[model samples]
Target: MRLALVLAGRYPDLRGSQVLVQQLADGIRGRGHAVHLVTYGAVASGRPGPRAGRIVRDLGLVVRLWRTVRREAIDLIHAHNYEAAIASLVVGRATGRPVVYHGHNALAEELPLYFRARRARGLAHRLGRLLDAHVPRRADFCIAVTEELGEILRRRGVAARDLTCIAPAAAPCDAAAHGPRVGSEALVCYAGNLDGYQNLGFLLRSFARVRARVPAARLVLVTHAAPGALRRAVGPGVEIVRAASYDEVRARLDAADVAVSPRAERYGFPMKLLNYMAAGKAIVASAGSAKGLRDGVTGRIVPDGDEVAFAAAVVELLSDAAARARLGTAARHAVEDPRAWDGVLDRIERVYRNVLAARSAASTDPEASAPDGLGVAAE
Candidate 1:
């Protein structure tokens, strides 16, 4: 099938959503399906330009996508995030093609984090809610990245028949060698964007507690984000490292004694968690963000917002070599299924076929095109 994978942001970036989209496109192409990445660029430019520039870029994307669909005879448009999804829906209406909306996170929960002031954040939340209520429902089908997100879409009025939750998958990396390191400094790593939604402030506070007990422990913030203010505030015992590529990011995670995801965003799955598991790193993540982990099995799951417990969990894993080895091994084994990627692709293929079938049926029978009747037909 010919597919156009749409993303508003730059593609091939280290960000979670972009990483997932890149993997999906690669997988689809590997499976002999035609997949075109319709995104801004193949590399990140470090900073978002002016608002006016962003608007012009998006407008350009809509025009480019419309032309690509017509020229390529694309069978489907799979759009990621709100902006791309909205654009795809516009093209879908004009060209009579099905569009799938792949939801990464709830806009209402994530939008407010971009703002600092209380009043501005409140306004952002209101605007996000308005989009959340309208956007996903317009898609021919909605694919949510986590069960939590699927439920959120349902609550926001996306019909259950039109939605499905598929957890993001990762290719397994070579397990990092875990040998005993008594009397050695323990290294903890947090890799991702430095956005406010990442809850880095909480990570810093928790790391401070971790340091109180294990004075030699060091925390590293590995990201492409410029660490100007964050670096100034991190003080001693914390290092902010910039990763030039995803390969370097993985290498840093594999080298670390422990990996962490301090984000409390419950609805969205943290893509780093998949990387941590793939790298066989013992992890400590807040309960809300720990999507696929089992407490004391694959990784240490601490209650959200509890710096004390989060720190203690990291400390325990740091000191216990055997525990770390056992957990890391289990984590690696969890994602080693050679068939995992194939399974994800299979489900997605089914969605595409069904959506196309439903659209065909609707075109032939006008009554089948009713808003409530729009859904991916059963396999």
Candidate 2:
């Protein structure tokens, strides 16, 4: 099958979206499918100027898809997010092709001010609703990342039959030891975007409290958010670093005795939870972060927003080496029971095969002419 992997960012950045896209595209192409990428470099951070702001982002991708689809013989377009979904919807409509929309979040609900669904007003503090309103029910298939998010789509009138819940996969952490040795003080890491919604302040406050009990404790903040603000607010007993190189990230993860994922979002599973688990590090995470773990069996879970519970959980885990090691062992092996990347793409390939076979068998003619600038076959 010929597949076009689409995203709204740069190709090889040190970000999750870019990393996931590059790996997914390579996997699909390696598995005997012709894979091509259609992206808007403007939105990607370090590529060039003029990032794809609200309205023009998806439209830009649509323009790129229009120029590449037929020329590359793209049989399926797997768009990564809403902006990319709009691109797939437009180009597929003009070319009479099918598209699989990867639902990274419940757009109208999670980023409400940003989506067009009229009921989405005040849902989020962003602006993207106008386009969401113009292009509703645009994809042939919608892939939801979590069950909570899937229900949001159904509530909004999306057909349950057209939906598939494919939880995002995390690469194993066995290979996370190729960087500099971590610090000596009991190292704890919280790595992610520096956005305000991340609630780093809460984590920092808890870390300060944890320091009173464990004086040698080191709280590592790996992010691109306001390091200056973080440095000012961190007080003592904290190490604020902007961002680490890819290898450095893994090294830091491996070096840390405990990793924390403090997520405040109600929707979208914490993908970082998987990374911490993969690294085999003891986790003293938010009650929300604990949702990804199996309680004491995997890692410790603390109540959300409760500094006492959060700090105590970290301190208790740090004091008990045997228990922490037990939990870490289980955490590291949690995902091994499931498929890794190669296994994940194998399942995806099956989905693509079935979609193609059904589309082909249903078509009456295989030799139908495609669009003037494109090609199409009626199935």
RMSD of each: 3.0, 6.2
Candidate 1 lDDT at 291 equals: 86
Task: Give the Å shift of residue 176 in candidate 1.
Answer: 11
The lDDT of each candidate is: 0.84, 0.67
TM-score of 1: 0.93
lDDT of 2 at 108: 48
What residue pairs are clashing in model 2?
114-127, 114-128, 114-129, 115-129, 116-129, 194-225, 362-379, 363-379, 370-375, 370-376
lDDT of 2 at 66: 79
Which residue runs does candidate 2 get wrong by more than 4 Å? 42-57, 112-136, 172-183, 224-232, 337-343, 361-379
lDDT tens digits, residues 240-345, model 1?
A: 9889897778767767889999999888888888888877889999998998899999999999999999999999999998898899889978877857767788
On the 0 to 100 scale, the lDDT of residue 14 in model 1 is 77
Query: What local lDDT score does residue 340 receive in model 1, on the 0 to 100 scale?
Result: 75
